[model samples]
Target: MKTFTSGWAFQKPDQNYFKKFIRLNNIAIDGIVYPKKILADIEGIPVLGFDDAHDIIQPDDLVLDVSTNPDLRKELEPFFAAKDIDCVSVPDYLDRLLSADQHDALLLPVAGIKASDIRKLKSAPIPDRFDAHFLDAESYEVASKLDGIFRHSQWQRLVEFDRDDPTGNVLFNVLLDLHARGLLKHLSA
Candidate 1:
C-alpha cells in the first residue's frame, strides 16, 4: 500500500495558502492508498492519530506555525475523516516526512516503478554507445531480451518475463528510448 500526508509551507494565513493546501490535500484524498497512521508524539506517547485533530493532539501540544489557519484546518477535517486518512498538524507532518522510512506509506495516487527496477538499469548497456558496446556480452544479452519483446507488448507487462533480471532493465530502458525517439509506437493509455 502507498502512504501520504498533506504538507504546505505557508508564510501567512491567506487565500493563497488555502488554495495551495487544498490542491495538495486533494492529491492525498484522491490517492489509491491513504496513510493509515499519522505520526505524532503526544503526552510522551508516540501516537498514531487519525482525522480527528482532538484525538491526535492536546491543546498543550505545540501547534505548528504552518498550521495556524483554523479555518483551513476545520475545512480539511471532514474531508480527511471521510477518507479515513490520519491527519496531523503541520509540525507533526513535517517531522513524519523527515523521518519517513520505506515502510511508511506516502500518498501514491499513481503507480511508479520501485527503486529496485531503476537499479537494474546499471547492468544494461548505455544505449547511446551502440556501436562500441553492441558486440559486448552484456549488450548482446540486452539485445536478445529486446528482440524477444519489442513493440509486441508494454514494457511493464513485458518485464514480467523474468522481471527481476538485470537485463530486463536494459530492455525496458531501451524500449523507453525507442518510444522517446518515435521509433516505437506508444500505446495511449
Candidate 2:
C-alpha cells in the first residue's frame, strides 16, 4: 500500500497527465492543497485540499514527481528526508501512478480551454447566475474570477484526454505496470 503526495500547483493541462496516471494506478493520493473554490470536481477521489503540501504530508509516505519549480522541491526535500520517506522522481514514478481500475467515469469534456481565458474568468466580476448556483457568496466571487481566466487564457489549450473512448479506462497502463515491477526508484534514500 504505497501512498502518494503531490502539490496543487501541478494541477494544469500538462500536469494532468500525471493526475490521470495516479488515478489509473489506484495509488492513494494526498497533499494537494488546492483552494476548494478552484476545484471543479474530484469525482469522489480521495484528496486533501489544504493551503500547503506540508500540511498533508507525513514522514512515512512517498512524495511523487512534482512540478519543475526548484523552490518547492527544495522545501519538501528536507521533510521527506527527515521522515525516512522515499521521494521518487516524476519520470520513475509515473508508471505506478497510472494503474487504477479502468471503470472510473469521465465527468467533463475531454478538452481544455485557454489559460488566458481562465485568467480572465478569475478576474471577472461574479455574475448573478453564478452567485445563485454556487450559493456561497465567496465561492461565487472566486469562481467568476477563475472562470474568466480559464475562458480567456491559451493555457487551457494544454489539456490532454484522460481515457480511451472504447475502454473508458485510462490509456496509460504500461507506466503503472512498470512501477509495480520495481523499475521505479526513490529520488532520496
Global lDDT of each candidate: 0.40, 0.47
Tell me how many residue pairs clash in candidate 1: 5
lDDT (Cα, 0-100) at 102 in candidate 2: 31
What are the TM-scores, per candidate, against the unseen true structure? 0.21, 0.36
- CA lDDT, candidate 1, residue 70: 71
Question: 1-189 in candidate 1: lDDT tens per residue?
Answer: 222233222233232422343354452321111123343432222333344443544333333223334765565556455545555544243334324524434332124532232234434544553566577766666665654332221132232344455665777888888888878876321
What lDDT is obtained when candidate 2 is compared to the true structure?
A: 0.47
Regions more than 4 Å wrong, model 2: 33-60, 95-189
Per residue, candidate 2 scores C-alpha lDDT tens digits across 68-99 of 56766665556566557677765545322222
